[model samples]
Target chain A: MRIEHELHARRRSRNVGLGLVLLAFVALIFALTVVKVRQGDLMEAYDHQPRVSLTPLDTPAGAPAEETPAGVPAEEAP
Target chain B: MTDINAYDASPEGEFRDYVALLKPRVMSLVVFTAFVGLWVAPGQVHPFIGFCAVLFIALGGGASGALNMWYDRDIDAVMNRTRSRPIPSGRVQESEALGLGIVLGTISVMMLGLVANWFAAGFLAFTIFFYAVVYTVWLKRSTPQNIVIGGAAGAFPPMIGWACATGGIGIESILMFMLIFVWTPPHFWALALFMKEDYHRAGVPMLTVTHGRRSTRRHILAYAVALAPFAIGLGLTSIGGPLYMAVSVVLNVAFLRGCWQIFRRSEDQAIADDYAVEKRVFRLSLYYLFLHFLALLVQSWLGGW
Candidate 1:
């Protein structure tokens, strides 16, 4: 009876350890999925090229925009 | 003192015991400093990524705590403060804690890499290894200088936070790291001074046990002297402002005075008062770290405004 009880205790402890391991593994997979979904197209593009340029911003009229030579709006003239 | 009852007969270790194994108090400090790091950095990260970074950092810290508890189970069983810990109390088996620690540690690092930047993930991995392998398994049993060198492990969260935001390390990150590193010795040794008997019983070789209390006191004073300059020096960096400088000055002055008082007292007085001075110093040390990081957060907010 003593030996049988000891074996059962050992088995129970092993199962508990296994459960904790499984929980941690599940959490890791969930985290990885979240990162993947969030990255979207950015990950794909970054993999292909190392550098990307930013698109220029459009300035509204009479909004203290960057001054062109002759004090004329470059976008307006051309 | 020798026969004090530290562990009580609780129910067989359950999920809660496992959570307790992670040392949540320590994890909180890790989270706060890492947040400060993320907040003060000079760029913006998506809110989601920032949150993920902090989460993974906290997990990594917890993982380290779990591993420490696992490895130190033998000594922990003997120490009064640690006797009630999961492993010592037979609530959770040692191997279970070890496995939990390893799995969580790996997951946290990998998630940090995928969610934030590789730099942050790599730093987290190194911090875990440093604490688990270098400190827990090696330095802890070997020398009294364990906490001094091991302090690096706790100091990495802020740098990890900085990396999450900037995707690289900078002077500001190093300063944050140095602040914690310098603060650790004095903070921990204060507790060690009070808990010398516990450490002696456990054969842990703390500074007070290996060297005399007088030496430990002197060491605390020395570290406090060094810490003040580093604390105040943060004010001159890009992250610093008048508010942080003022707070740092006052805290450092108060801390230095405390250390001086600790140094002036003899072992007899410490024993007579049940090491009240040492205990007060330990509590103050906790407040010191929180206030320092809080001051940094305030400075960052004020700077933005």
Candidate 2:
């Protein structure tokens, strides 16, 4: 059906490989950003870690897990 | 190979020839070793930074390949093993390879510095220079010890990777470097023994070409013997545990036995089986590096598990 198979196979593969590498780099940045956003944008997260949470875990009635940030209101910290 | 200028007949270069310039197969090994180095280090690198560092390291490795192709194109045309490569086959222009090498080398190093520590980027820069200039341009045509010294270029990856994460080197990384360094001669020499004519044809002065086959065989055994302590030594380091130690012991014993088989064989014997022992050992050398690294990964993973 196509003589171009013999013609440009090598070129296509090389372009695809480079394209894939570049795409991966871009995708990683986007993914990491999403992870950071999902993790509540802890800018210092790398010093710790930021990860995506899939299902929200249920909290016990009227109890909060997180300690309030220094001088923050309870509702905002929650 | 047709003419050294085959690409001229084809006009604009095909994409694959550009890939050939990067030498992807070699890049695979470099990237993996560097990944292991980065992984086994003490602290965590941001996943994004880690990914960028490894990608740039791979690009740096590819850049070295381009420069090597640019410099060695003439000899590559003569060697049967290399005659079909892009530069030698005229599928890629010499200037293109050189340009790609310089651009990629510069970008990779600079980006690495921006993303990781300067120490890792600096190490990567030195590695590209060592491979492209020190090993390929200077030593390869000059002496039998070419790969021996040139092997250091390949050996630097893990250290660079460790530095990428830890911003420093340690005994563990040094041992990883030594494992590859000690193993290189025998690996290349075994390939040289079988591809003896290729080196001879290309005037590349590989150990087999400089020394006779007997000497080459002796060198392979000697290197394999020397490699035992280093290989076993690595298993005793922070990276090693019972599982790694066991794998190391088994691998070293099998490797030594393989070398002994090659050592005992005569030229007549090698010819009888088409250098089966040499070929077997060559293939084993690939697995040998791989399994050693795999063992480290296993140790790290299972220990954490």
What C-alpha lDDT does candidate 2 achieve relative to the native structure?
0.84
Each prediction's total of clashing residue pairs, residues at least 3 apart in sequence or on different chains, is 1, 4
lDDT (10s digit) by residue, model 2, range B236-277: 887788888888899889899999998899999999999999
Native interface contacts kept by each candidate, as a fraction = 0.00, 0.33
Tell me the deviation in Å of residue B126 in model 1: 0.3
The reply for model 2, stretches above 4 Å from the true place, is A1-78, B1-8
lDDT of 1 at B184: 96
Cα lDDT for residue B119, model 2?
A: 91
CAPRI rating of model 1: incorrect
| CA shift of A51, model 2, Å | 32
For TM-score, the strongest prediction is 2
Per-residue lDDT over B167-227 for candidate 1, one digit per residue giving the tens place of the 0 to 100 score: 9999889988999999999999998787655777777778887888899999999999999
The Cα error of candidate 2 at residue B177, in Å, is 0.3
RMSD in Å for all candidates: 10.2, 8.5
Best by DockQ: 2
Look at candidate 1 and give me any clashing residue pairs: B13-B91
